[model samples]
Target: MSAVLLDHHRLQYLHEAVRLGSVRAAAEALDINASVVSRQIALLEKELGLSLIERLSRGIRATEAGALLVERFRKWEADQADTVAKLRELQGLKRGHVDIVLGEGFVSDLMSGPLGRFWLRHPDLTMAFDLAGTNEVVNAVAEDRYHIGLVFNPSADPRIRVATASRQPLCAILPPGHALAGLNRPLRLHELVDHPLGLMHPSYGTRQILAMAEAAERIALAPKLTTSSINVLRHFVKSGLGLTLLPAFSIAADLADGSLAAIPIDNRLLSSSEACVITRRGRELPHAAGQLLRFLSGQMRAFRAGEPAAKMKPRATRR
Candidate 1:
């Protein structure tokens, strides 16, 4: 073939056929007849003067020429999507959407206050928030799955760039009328070793930090109860099951309402955690998402500074 014009529909059929490993499957996915899909792929192969796929017993595999074309075309599709999203963003804040992913630890009064405030300002803008583990949040942001992410005690990840971070102290959460609630000073590590401990699962960053603190002090903390849910831990502590340790932001409302008392940790290793707002390193966020990112970062800083004094009502099934 000397030269060829790009036929978008035919190229789409070929891309789908390669992706699904069968023309019939691609046709089914695209809600079209199988013969049309097959014919389109044949035309694309003839124009390109290349055998684009190798038929297998069950399905198929893309040949070398097909693989390279598909890869470049996917990149083109991504760039085109980015360009369209940018265009939509220019219509003003009232019409666009922002997708956010965050860890369960951040479903707090601190978050709700800012979220509520922002939505009230841009009532028509759509927002989707998803909960994942800290590491998952980072990975999702790096993979461009979300416009922004919030993670507690986030570690260094080269694929992501931190937009803002606030140091959150890990505090001992004591139930109302618990013995330790009366203490004025920060709690020492050894002081907590004997308490009936309710803690988050070992996979949690907070729990990992607590473990390190225990190891440094030559003490092993056998938690009486362990759960993956921060809300569960909060409720357990509130019921006087046992003391639990978490970031101050996670339980700020409980502390304010006198349901739980927060005593700062004295150990340097366990003193504080970091809550960071992160985005993909090189990709520029859409205008609305970028606005929300800055808003969330400010809210984190405000919470760290102890600005919002009133008890904030929790909303929805958070985290």
Candidate 2:
């Protein structure tokens, strides 16, 4: 093996080639000619005495050895970035980036205040906020695509470590002056079935739980309007079309301002939801992200402590 072949340039070329899956595509992405990219990859293979890629009609794919090396290189790159973040922390937290992806439900009043305060404390720090579904957020964090994740009712997986979690029960959302608005007790699942229903799409965390309840009771749910967006469900509810089911945090402001009525559900399966803050298992987060995570944990704790419990009627007949 030639010592020159172990340099950063050759390794970078190999990484790009595997990532883009074609020498020509890698060259285009890197703004270099195809010949330069192919020559470096050939030299790398010669030095290692192994073919790194297999050409195909459409593009190229990495050999097993090449794939393993690229995986290691990515981990090494992450470790180097962590080291730099730590060094910046010693320099007084002047500058760093925190990448966070959360469920769209969190974009509402749930996170606005705490995140605003976090930014105020570190004006020089940068953060990127992305909205995705709960499961997608969990997957993104587990894959190390983001430093922090906030999601609802995520699956039990070994790849993610939950830093803070709060159990939030499902609530029945009713428009102001609706017939059910005056009830202080928990509403039964059967009680809500007769009303016109506007449900979040099946992909949402709440809808998943609702589906379980429907099967458990041998009942069918016929939503008059189905949408993937929470805002659309809220809009439908506000227009007096039908009641929608949501976790309490999503309608906190609406309930507070007398615009909506939030009733707790009495059923066991749909009684509550879990809101979690997660990070990749065994991976140390960057300093900026870590600080924000701690702050978020505290905020969740305080919110849970201060939030009122669901009002439920005593169990008797199903109705």
* Cα lDDT tens digits for candidate 1, 1-319: 5878868788778788887889889999999999998888888889888988888998778999888777566545645666777887676435778888887777775465788898888888887889887777887777566888888776788878988877666777777577776666667778888888888776677887888888888998889998878898888887877888877677767767778777777777765566778887877766778788887777654235433223322211211
TM-score of each: 0.72, 0.77
Candidate RMSDs in Å, in order, are 7.3, 4.5
Evaluate model 2: give its lDDT.
0.76
Q: What's model 1's TM-score?
A: 0.72
Which window of ten consecutive residues has the lowest lDDT sum in model 1? 310-319
> For candidate 2, which ten residues in a row score worst on lDDT?
309-318
Per-residue lDDT tens digits for candidate 2, residues 1-319, read 5554365676777788888788888899889999998998898888889888889988888899887777666666667778899997888868999888987677765465877787789888898999888677877777567889988777788989998888766778887677776665677788888899888766667888788888998888789888778788788889988998877677666666677767777777776567788998888988788898998877652236336533322221223
Name model 1 segments beyond 4 Å from true.
Answer: 1-80, 91-93, 301-319
Find the candidate with the highest TM-score and give its number.
2
> How much lDDT does each candidate structure score?
0.75, 0.76
User: What local lDDT does model 2 show for residue 99?
Assistant: 87
- Clash list (residue pairs), candidate 2: none
Question: What value does the lDDT take at residue 274 in candidate 1?
Answer: 69
